[model samples]
Target: MSVNNIHEWDKGEYNITTDIKKIDRTAVHSYLTRSTWAKGIDFETVSYSIDNSLNFGLFHREEQIGFARLITDHATFAYLCDVYVLEEYQGRKLSNFLMSCIHEHPVFSKVRRLMLFTLTAPWLYAKYGYEPVNQQNYAWTILRKDMYL
Candidate 1:
């Protein structure tokens, strides 16, 4: 089916399955490259990571158009990352739909503290209750390369 036809699905049109079986690595690489924030990611590395990470892909007629992933321990903290919608498919609120899926997914629902960072689209993320954190007030330490490497 064409994207246009899929886009016309009622709010509940296509089934939002959590199975990542249909994920398109090529499309994901394209989207990540377009995302700009993912500049240094090697496609092979990204493919490997996606294969192992807790991730989701939004499909319209079996074509992956949007993607997101979470880093979590399944109990305490979850960090959302690499959320992206293909440029051609933007403005259709697919990102929001994808987020809703992630929020309602069984594996992610119990996460206590969810965090994400974005250089753009703060408004979109804020609509989902994410806020900028004050780094200075937070207790954290940065490790220098000499210490760990």
Candidate 2:
């Protein structure tokens, strides 16, 4: 789907926006480089992913403080990833605000399967109705643990 306009939600001085132009690539790359999940990921790859995905950028004043990328076709499925608030900004409920904006966004309404990979915060995702998958899953994954090495 073509992006016809920008989307934004605000809380006091903090806001989250869907305007890709407002995203700070350098800041995001800097955070992700030290992040456990996207560690060692290249800047080119980060830029490419942002360009292709439906991204939500979290901001304080004019600074990019957090980001989340949703890889979706806007109908059936979406993979939410790279979600975070800056270290100094955590515990301020900014992530909850970000997720609220994402939940209210139109793109996710028709999606049947929404999934995210996070080993750190189950409680956070649980508030959004995401639960742990039990049962013997037969799905296979081709993990490249050393791909960036």
Among the numbered candidates, top TM-score falls to 2
Off by over 4 Å in 1: 1-16, 139-149
Residue-wise C-alpha lDDT for candidate 2, range 105-147, written one tens digit per residue: 8887889989887887788899999976664764446788766
Per-model C-alpha lDDT, please?
0.70, 0.89
- Candidate 2 structure, TM-score to reference: 0.94
Every model's TM-score: 0.78, 0.94
Q: Tell me the tens digit of each residue's lDDT in model 1 across 47-138.
A: 88687767777777667777888878878888899998777878988888877777766556688888887787898888888888887868
> In terms of lDDT, which candidate is strongest?
2
